[model samples]
Target: MESARIPFTERYHATQHGGIARAANSSVTCKTAAGRTATPCAAVQQGGAGANGHYRMAYIDVDSDARTANSSSATLRIPAGSRVSYARLYWGGSLRGSGQKAAKDNGRVLLAEPGGRYRQVRADTMTGHRPHSATEGFQASAEVTELVRNSGGGAYTVAQINMATGHSTAGVWGGWTLVAAYENKKQPLRRIALWDGFQSLGADRRELSVRLPGLRIPANSHGLAGVVAYDGDRGHGNDTLTVRAGQHRAHTVRDTANPANDVMNSTVTDLGRPTMRWPAYRNTLGFDSDVFDITPALRSGGDRLTFRFTTTRNPGYLLGALFVQTDTRR
Candidate 1:
């Protein structure tokens, strides 16, 4: 089969203009587990010389309609048979308060879905904590690929906030942003590609392999396409990278110049100097880009599909990210 080029398209969604308060009203008041509630932005001083400090807390409720009734919802609707390649949440905002030193607080944003399913989208110990007295700015983000996949095209009812501490001195205010990338075409149920986050590969961990999760393929897939971004190589000679499925050897990856033996129409991109170094190497090295096809070895056996890789030399190549495209039976 001819090689296929899979391109990714991206879109961003965000809440209405103005702060979180304007987006949705605080329906539920903040209360401690012991049923203790403090006035909003009211500083509670702590006693003792060693404990020379104070904190505050408050709770805000983000209305479902207000949060999703914006341009971001445009990509929420996934075409039938198509899948989301990637989804992430980018959130940032300023906190209002009055204090000599900037107040610090930890909070969580909950994504409340239908059927009573609640997922904590963002959780951090220090958010919106600044040193300035009048106000402080902070930001937090997370990858929600799995969350988007599980949503099943249902809308999130609300983005709930939970303040663990320092709520009184600083009132939480921010906007929620959603960014998603989807496949352009409606892929068949059998043909799908799951992106696995960056996998670290080194001399100690030479072979990097991952099994496709939550996939039920009764028979062998028609073809397999694999794309990887790698950096930090130590070797100069031509090193061969092998792709395998179970015990079957699929494709051997080498310099893209040798296209005669390359069946996947593999391509490479050279990403100059290494910004960072792995433990094995103390100095920076060049990086390599690879995109290839491994259809020959992508057969299903024992109800599991696993991809493995091994290099001829210790290039010290760190596998940045991997995406596997294959066809399975419906």
Candidate 2:
């Protein structure tokens, strides 16, 4: 089955609430190497190695609980019946130094799970600072599907750059933006129905039609089935429902005036009045369970299915809902 992707952005700020990294020498005073006065610095200095090294990088620590206080961490919930099959994380920002080492120092964006486990989502090796220029930084992304799937379909969480490791590098100083992609699990048997709240058919309107597109049938699938529910003005009249592919008739269900006459083939009931009255009919046509099949009616290269209704009396028939089902193939 084909999958669907849902994209969501993190709901937190990267720098607020003590999320940035600052080195011990981040505020060090710079003195002229030979014979000049020390200069006051505004940004962390680049180059040099040691405890008081000048290179320092800031990072956002994305914590699951930080969503309320910091906003850098986020939790995405999967719907109750659906499972997550795949996921990915995207993040990007700027680096402030040059050369391979500075680029390597860019660190990585980490994805954190609920139980203190973490995985590297993407590397932030984009380096070089272009001050006051249109082009300024590098952007990167990473796939976190395994971690997301392991989280078991609910509350998948993520952390900002270097937060999971608690180690900060120099020459990396920009806020990061993040978004996640997820694929929903596929169902073995799928049902597509037509029951939009505000639509129906009647005497004023004699026919109702619906077009369903993009339905996929796996190579190992068995077949398809369909059912429809309908009613008339006084629970009287003969009507027919048809399923088609372009001009090809796939299946049809016909209603009779006498409920008892079609009792074995349909369900006849009185379901209220005005809003819903009696003489409602529900039936499934084309093949019984032993040999149920409708694949031959479906066009091989196309995925368009159409449903139609016709009536023969005044205050004709109002269609309720039409449902089509297909076997699930692993």
Error of 2 at 223 (Å): 5.4
Model 1: residues with Cα > 4 Å off, grouped in runs: 1-85, 88-186, 191-200, 213-220, 232-239, 246-250, 253-285, 299-302, 312-315
RMSD of each: 19.4, 26.8
User: Please, what are the lDDT tens digits per residue for candidate 1 over residues 232-316?
Assistant: 2222333344555554544554333323232111122211111111111111112122334454555542234455554444423
Best-fitting candidate, scored by TM-score: 1
Model 2 agreement with the true structure over 54-86: per-residue lDDT tens digits:
223223233445432111333343544444333
Q: Report clash pairs, candidate 2.
A: 12-71, 56-170, 188-328, 270-278, 272-276
State the local distance difference test value for candidate 2. Answer: 0.30
Instruction: State how far residue 198 of model 1 sits from its true place (Å).
Output: 5.3
Which one is best on lDDT?
A: 1
- Judged by whole-model lDDT over C-alpha atoms, candidate 1 comes out at 0.34
C-alpha lDDT of residue 253 in model 2 = 36
Predicted structure 2, TM vs. truth: 0.29
TM-score of each: 0.35, 0.29
